[model samples]
Target: MTTKNLLVELFVEELPPKALKKLGDAFASVLCEQLRTQGLASASSVATAYASPRRLAAHVTHVRSKAQDQAVLQKLMPVSVGLTADGQATPALLKKLASLGADVSDPAAAVAALKRQGQGKAEALFYDSLVKGVTLDVGLQKALDEAIRQLPIPKVMTYQLDTDCGMPHFLPGWTSVHFVRPAHGLVALHGDTVVPVKALGLTAGNATQGHRFEAAKTPVVIAHADAYAQTLRDDGAVIASFAERRGEIARQLAARAAEVGGGCRPIEDDALLDEVTALVERPNVLVCQFEPEFLEVPQECLILTMKANQKYFPLLDAQGKLTNKFLVVSNISPADPSAVIGGNERVVRPRLADAKFFFDQDRKRPLESRVLGLAKVVYHNKLGSQGERVERVSAIARAIAQQLGGEALARQADQAALLAKADLLTDMVGEFPELQGIMGGYYARHDGLGNDIAEAIEDHYKPRFAGDELPRNPVGVCVALADKLETLVGMFGIGNLPSGDKDPFALRRHALGVVRMLIEKDLPLDLGQILATSAEVFGERVFTSGPMPSETPEGSIGIGSIGVKIDPETIPKVRDFIYDRLSGSLREQGYSAQEVDAVLALRPQRLSEVARRLAAVRTFAALPEAPALAAANKRVGNILKKADAEVQPVVRPELLKEPAETALHAALEQVASVADAAWADGDYTANLKALAALKGPVDAFFDQVMVNADDPALKANRLGLLATLHQAMNRVADLSRLAA
Candidate 1:
């Protein structure tokens, strides 16, 4: 087959910068996949995606001009239905052959040529045919149409295109088209020839426009399919590759920051970098400055305003502190860049000033004063106001702190929890919801609250996502755990559980956060106790009588109550939910599923012990006796479960008439004492490894003894012996779960 590289481009109005990269990648990948599926492109063909502010293009190598013809064998029908008793073609078979473009003039010959294949109860007739290959023109048209239909466009625009009245294809003055943006041009080339594909109300050509203001030529002509990128760069003054443009911008930013030479560097934010790259065709990094007085506000406020509103990167000093200087990425380059720098600086001043104003107004009253205002803000219709939620959180925090520390730490956590949500009523937080906890911390310091309380307020929302930092101080840990537990218990109590991917309340994240804090912080708190305390704090709120409130009334601030009751069964569900999240998290951390299941089956209350237990199980699994012991444990569990009466681990030595039972009993006594002692001292690894010595005795007892003997006393004695073995092996984890 003759092959050549293929090129396709779509020029449009400026696209959404955040979605541009994804759209470009999807367009190229989908188009290439479609061609490969149709056998027009080989499996080894490579695809390169090109994206700029105004264009999306793809170049695929080794695409054939036409797909090869194929031979197809299709089953027609059963022999009984397709032919008469004498094997002559029936009218039905002749009509089917006519629809398939087969010559029906000689029906007998056609019937004789049909192959016989066996069906379930009878024989079936098969027909063979040749399928013609699809030409490049038709195949490209289908590929282009389907690619355009599947772009991951954030939103669609509807516009009309001007029509050429003299053209035969025109029906009226204008034609309506819906696309990501208004399509102005499309280019499709195979080797050096135009492929003549049409899409989005435009005919394919070999020319496309370049940078709107900086292009060296208008309607740059692409010479060949392989020359698209080079042609655009040389004649159109456009980089034409999204990744290349991003790399160029990063290089310029680094160079300019180094030239400034005060240990200065651009603040690192990939999302901001990507957005800026999508907004420019040719990036020119320039330095701009703001008034130093604005730095009096929190650096977070200033940096966010610059990056979010003006799309600029704020410079940072050696100490990771924001400076008044910032970097701007402009699309056009000029001999003297003073005009661009001044324009960006002027545009950014007002945004920074707004942030400063909000900060100033927010500090006028202390965070403590904002507490009353939260009463007017509804948190949830079923859960009451933010003020009520604060109260519940405060109670839970204090309870946890008292258990972990003394009264002093308890007081600090209680105070922090009380004011944590007060910032939601602040002007700064109201303007930027992302700064809620941060603003609360600042306001607390302004009100002369101690650093302990202020830091706790700031750190209460620690670990907002996976791998995020945890609370820095003990007080913060208490409050964070309490806040998360309250949400889990209260939501589960009201039956608002997450189903499938619908986790509107983010209960999964909250549960994971709680698990991380407990395990990583090495806190000795029991998960079940924390859940019960959190549920008690909710009191009658979980039992409010009505359908769960999905939305709050517009313009109404007072807390509303749902009239429903909390079911007693909801507590166990909440516990199971937490355990499920813990299990998944452990697996993601590199533990195998069997190891995790064995440890979690015990449902250990102290999450701090889970990691140690898992480690112990991993060590035990490598032992030579692990398999046999695990199997024996599984057998013992089954026998005890099936026993008619309740079987206890206590065994009477005199009832052990069998020698194997007596030997197993002696081994269990020695091993259980040693393992139990190690477990009490927290040496879980050593505790589990001690059970390896029981493999020999356990196998012998199971092989020689009948647990369901006709004599009730003997059977009970055997069950007790097995029960003792089961208890000894499962101190760290359920060994049965490790069995194959």
Candidate 2:
């Protein structure tokens, strides 16, 4: 058996750490799928991808030299031009034909068209366009070229443009190769001799280098990808393995921390570690010490300042207490790391001093004292000021607390919500934006409001990203939900909703945060009511914007701020935007688009409740007969959809006649009884099954009987029966929206 290997590499300027893994995995998976779809065979390996700040590479072994060609057919749908009655292509059709590359002006082409052949069969039309008939064992080189050409990267430029100029890629226009990074060169060598990699206008060689300072040059020639990686490592740098880098760093960190009478715990920053590892060919962990006085500043401020700003890992003692020392993973082994440690400590000292100043200033006047200052800080001119939002949040939180029945915590939640945004205007939060909620919690604790209030202040921003933690305490949950709701209402009030990847306000994050708290924390607060109250706060702003210039009250104050008069129509529009956010949020949890429609049809007041009903229906949908039941639902749905097409019919039992109609009616009655009992008990699965049982009878009734009969009395009876089915079904879901 013959064997071939494929290798691709890219070298470029340093990439943003965030785009590394995603770009690496995308190139490999997209290329692999494209290859298989194009009929390449005997490919049984994953393309091993390696990514760094400046380079990305992929290696595929056991690659076939040729692709297994298969026939593909295309269809020529009827053109808009008229055809002759005898099924001949007409003069008008021929006149417009040249637009599609048909040489209709030629006598032979016109004659063939006038004769009319090769109609109806999709394959025949496509086959005629092919320059050659389907042949076996087509060259794999062409397939690889085609696949790579189609890989979509958000940004690309071409160094060398091919003859067929498509959209310019995210690389140099003259560069006729596709690479996620710069392709310094390709190396397709076999032993000492170089193998040709000229298929896509690329040539391979046998030269590589190691770390610049340690081993800048190597006199080795690599024949294969595996050997190439090993040779580089043998020279001085460990190449090709992220696991090895992580292990080396962890080992050094552990031994160093042990010397300090403690051990380094891994921070929850895999992304940071990955980028740091890529910065060096060899990773050496160095533990650096700082003055313990910095510990007086909030741990979050110190840790975030170190990790987010400096890319350093903070250390912890055996008891999980924060230590004055931190671990800095370096690319090169420094001769005097004490200098490195001292440099980092000096940089961090000023940051902590800023934190200390904010803490001391904030405590001198409690967070509540600063709440009035937020009134001058406008959140959105149309949505009211920051102080107004705080009041709205307080109301929303208290209502949520009342719903959860934490009277005392609910009151504390109201106070916490009012004070939450007060930290936004603080000096510390201005420097470290991520520490907004954390600092609020710290200041609250310093004021002796205790842990619950302090936690509520911090927990309000519990989930800053997907899969992040949600508020665990009830007060925290209320405050968090309130905070997100206020932001959503305010931003949407100003018509600043996210549009096509442009979200200046981070509304998507706020919406998702609301979803996480509702679903993960299982907060039972209704979103509809909360939005209504918040909307009222906005509505007042709208009304105060002044009604259409009226004759009365001519001397009254004119209402307009930041050039927008908050009109009545804007409130419902903003509310609909919130609903859209809710539907999208629920869609991420594996709910079908139709399921989202069904649950949303119920006019959900609370986002958490909306998620619950959707979850219940989703679980119920997985039962053995779910699809069949959904099919049955479609039948009942059709009858009801048509019946209620004009108006929703109220079931009037008096107009009953046909046995089939009566039987379906009685079955619906029994189902309704079960549905009510289950719905009241919150057993939606049982309710859905009970509703599903009506599908068989519904199908039979629809087949055996007609609803729009000649007799008016009998027609009303049948319509009433369909209406009864609709009412029973709506209890579980708006099955009328179910797909056929």
Candidate 3:
């Protein structure tokens, strides 16, 4: 069968910049998928997607004008029900054959033509027939409709169209049409011929409007399915493919930055590039500059306002310091180009001025002065004002600091925690809540506080997102841990837990932050104790409250004010929650699920040692003695569990009656001493490797010595020996988990 390439395009108003890429890919994928499903496209076909600010298009190769006819076999009814004992036609069988348009006019012949197989009740009658092929016109219409329905449109708009289904109308008789935008044109082509299809009340055609103002042709005409992209680019003065347009923009940005010399480069941000790519069809990169005075403001404030408010890329010098000049990706190119550059420079001056003004005004009041203002702001109706929360955080910080650092560290941490949220009241932070910790750090330096306190305040919210860096100094770590733990304890205590993806309180992120800091920083703090201290600061009311919070103010013996009414299970649940977060983190770092599962099963209190334990487990699993040891360990655990009385690790040597038991007892004593020494030195790998000595004894003991010996004393002694073996094997990780 012969095939020709196919093209489909939807020209609408500008799409949402963030959703444009997803919408375009989805449109192309679904349309081609539907075509293949209908057999109008073959396995050899390839689909290419094209998206611009105002258009979404797809081109497919090896698409047929009409799908091939297919032979189909359909099951009918049970053989016994369809035919009589002698294989004669039954009335019911003839009726079913008639419904299927089989030649039931000759009922006996039709029944004779049917095939039957299987035995007894499983036997069934089957019919075979050839289905008619579908033409491109009918198939394209179905595919086009399905593509539109499946688009990941961020929002939808409803408009009206006339009776002819080709033009918009607001008249009484018009039909309502809903879509991402009011689509003005639709194009569908097979080779050079138009495939007459309609979508969103628009008829498919060969002509589509290009760039709103800069097109070389009024309505760019696509001559053929294969020529669509080239013709549109040359006549429409627009880059039709999103990837090509983005690459062009990036290349221009880099070339222009190099021309600027002095090692200048545009700040790298992929998200910003994607959004800019979605906002333009023909990108024209231009250099623009602001007054040097604006540079006096923290570059964070200036860079943020430029990127967020104006969508411009600020240039950085060799030291990674922001310069006065920035690059803009304009949508138009002019003969002189001076006017476009001037217009952008003029537009950005006011935005930069506002940032500088906010910075200057904010520095006048020390962060300590703004501390009182936080009391007026609502931290949470359940957790009281931000001031009360600050106090709880300070208390937690002090407790953690005393354990990690000393009096000097505790004092500085306490001070940093107190001033951390004060920036929420600043004009700069008020305008951009994302700059809360950042602005506080800047203001702290102006108040004559040392860099230690300033950096701690700034980094209190370190790791606001995944892959973000942790606190810089010990003070920062102290405050960051305190703040996160306070929120977690308060929220979990009051039952404000996260369910599914709906984390309004970001409890999961907060827990993950705690885990990362402990493990990565190798902090010696106990997670359970830290949580208990955080809970202690909240006092009796919060923990003792019913299952749900009281919905009342805190400090009044009301469980509701502290948040929800949590039960006794709250603490354990929170602890489990943190470990779950740890498990996921470890897996993402390339550890196997079994290794992580085994290590976490023991509930290691000091999270800093988790990695060492995992490494040890991996080493042990590879040893020749590993499989037998792990299996023996599993058997030992089962025996201990079924023991009628408690099986202690302590064994009475005199009761070691069996020879197999005697050998295992002596092996464990020697292995335990070596493993204990390795464990003491934190040589977890060596500790686990030392267990290779016990494999022979363990296997022999399990095979020869009966754990359930008829004499109670003998059985107890054997169970004690197994119990001792189990404990020795699991110090680093539960080896039984490695068993297949």
Candidate 4:
């Protein structure tokens, strides 16, 4: 037994900073399997991997010297065939056949071997053979080779001479060995000096480089793979951990902001810095300032320009007002840092000027005037332009508003939807794609539109992503819903439905946005009605087979699903992509997946109703006796199944003879009234609590009475009472369907 260490690094041209870590993990996983399949086992902890933009590496400690030895031989010799077709064999027969691999050619001879007499007989001879074998290093090399050969690398290239390497790899030319980018080189080290990675044309060396900036002139020597990371960090310019980088950057940004009149707080921007670290080997923070007059620009514009364009962090005052200064994290500490600050300020100047131009230009036309421009913008090639889209949205929004009985808001909603996308064609939005809706609102307000309408225009695209905020007002929710539905229906109608991971039209986002409006904002909507109205408005543009089937159809049915015909009897696929995203959004607010799934199972047509029902179920489920009550519900279901077979039955309290039956009937009546009131009030939790109360009496009634009696009348009577219980139970939820 010998302890060993193995290292394999794929050094390549600067990789996609974001995809490097994931690819490294994938490479290690793929290699680990290959090694294990070759019977290379580790005596200590399992293999581990590390990755950076330029390299992917792995190490396995305490590996066995070689796979344990074992024998390999066929065990095929039918006991019946040991003797001739007869049951016995002659003494000469055994001796004559001994030349073959058989122990005995007689049935009794084999049987006699199993039962040794008091006197011992000659011991049976054994066959010799060897199992699959490999020397440790050879096995390791073969494993590495197989892994490299089978590794999945897309868009691979080779910079060297072409060779017919015995592997079907991603690279078209040069040696079979390849990397995602050109392999800058590789180092497969075993303890010390150059462990030749000749297979990949890389020679392991003690030489490695550190920071591309500060340490650009320094070459650090590393004796082993374990020390390679440390050497790079000690001599290199930065740390590898993403958390550490973010923490350090935030600390420096805060400290710089504090040095000024105000403290700088980081605005949540979807984890941009985590990805930024992969691009820079080191980070140097500097405080930069622009003309205070620039602060007049919308806070959003300022933040976006600083972050999206220049990768600068905006500073905020103690009162949370945007300040005139910004923080820039640079990879290099310049001789005159003020030069870097000047360069960034210069780059952002045009963007701010553009914003100012749009802002000033928008003041003259007002949103009302721009509505005409959206028509020429073309919302869709088949359906129409943004102008046409605006009209359709107006119609759909008005219809939804009328449905919601918001006559005034409905009129405003229609107006908002029509004007929402108009901003897309405006100078401000044209310059900054992110300000589409906000600019529309800004223009509307400048045009003297009512605050409600302006807000609706701005809010139509609320909750742009999962966990993002929803529209602040109900009118905004209605208009936003109408706006998103119009796009989804129009695109889906035109055969431009999302295929695979490709959603060119952003329809899925629109759908999820719609779902969120319903669930989070308590907007009551019927998805089918919304989709139908949108489709009708768009006419020929709608292109789906139907509303994506809520459930797979009966046997051998052919309906397209994710680019393939769904199988008959396929369990209703819960469009998990949508639900998972929804669940994640809800989970962040402290909702559990099971609770969300339970509500989703009811196929809530309105997101608001789903939230209400989820709240109720979660509350009811917390009761200690909830499981027992659910069991009672199941029993009521069983009785109703039999009760349905007979003529229509009704609960007639006058005919009740048993006290248990009478009590159960009375309980149902009381619960029904309360449940109906709760449902009307949109208080599903109260309804669930009311229903749970029936469980105790339901159990007592079933115990004391027979559902099927000798007398047909009594059986039917009992069954009918249970049916009433079932009807009551169904109001809250089909508890039987929920997982315990």
Q: What is the C-alpha RMSD of each candidate to the true structure, in Å?
A: 2.8, 8.7, 3.2, 8.8
Clashing pairs in 1: 543-564, 543-565, 544-562, 544-563, 544-564, 545-562, 545-563, 545-564, 546-563
Q: Which 10-residue span in candidate 4 carries the lowest summed lDDT?
A: 565-574
lDDT of 1 by residue, 1-740 (tens): 88999999999999999999999999999999989988898899998999898999999999999999988888898899999989999999999888888889999889887889996558999889877888889998999999999999999998766665233575654667799998889999999999988887788889999888888889899999999999998889899999999999999999999988789999999999999999999899999999999999999999888888889999999899999999999999999999999999999999989999999998888888889877667666677668878998999999999999989889989999999999999888888888988888888989999788888888888889989999998988999998888888878876789999999999999999999999999999988888878877777643222222333366644243455445678778988998999999999999999999999999999999999999999999999999988988888888888888887888999999989989999988898788889989999999988999898888888788888899988888888777777778887899999999
Ranking by TM-score, best first? Answer: 1, 3, 4, 2
Model 4 lDDT per residue over 1-740, tens place? 55456666666667776665566666666666666666665434366765655666666655555677766543323334333445465444455445434466454655454322122233222223356556556775676676666655656665663344333553546445455676645566555534544456554555655666676436656567566566667875545444455567767766777777545565555456655655665677888788888777678777876787777778887777888787888878878898888888888788778777767876776666777765445344355456666777888889888887668768778777777887776777777899878877777887888788888888888868766788877678778877887766655444576778998877678768877777665656776566667666754333223222223365544233222221221112213334555666677778776676666655655556666777787888888767887777766666666554853447767768888888988888887888899888978888888877777787788789877787878877777777667666656556655545
Instruction: Tell me the tens digit of each residue's lDDT in model 2 across 1-740.
Output: 35455554444455456666566555556545554555442457556666555545555665554454343333333432344445456565555455545576564454354322355632122213322322112433343454456545556644453434333442445556545444444454323335444433444566654565665456334556657567667763645454566667767767777777755464657777766766656777887777898788778878888887778888887777779888887776778778877777788777778778877776787887888888766565456567777888888788778778668867888888888888888888888888888888888887888788888898888677777888768889888877777777766666776889898887788877876676666666666566666656544443223333332266876466344334456556655766677788777767899889978877665555665577667776666656665665566566656763543555566666556666787788887888889889978777777766676677678778877888876776676676666667777566556544
True-structure lDDT of candidate 1:
0.88
Candidate of highest TM-score? 1
Give Cα distance to truth, residue 247, candidate 3, Å: 0.5
Output the better candidate (1/3) by TM-score: 1
Where is model 3 more than 4 Å wrong at Cα? 79-92, 162-173, 541-567
lDDT (C-alpha, whole model) for all candidates? 0.88, 0.65, 0.89, 0.66
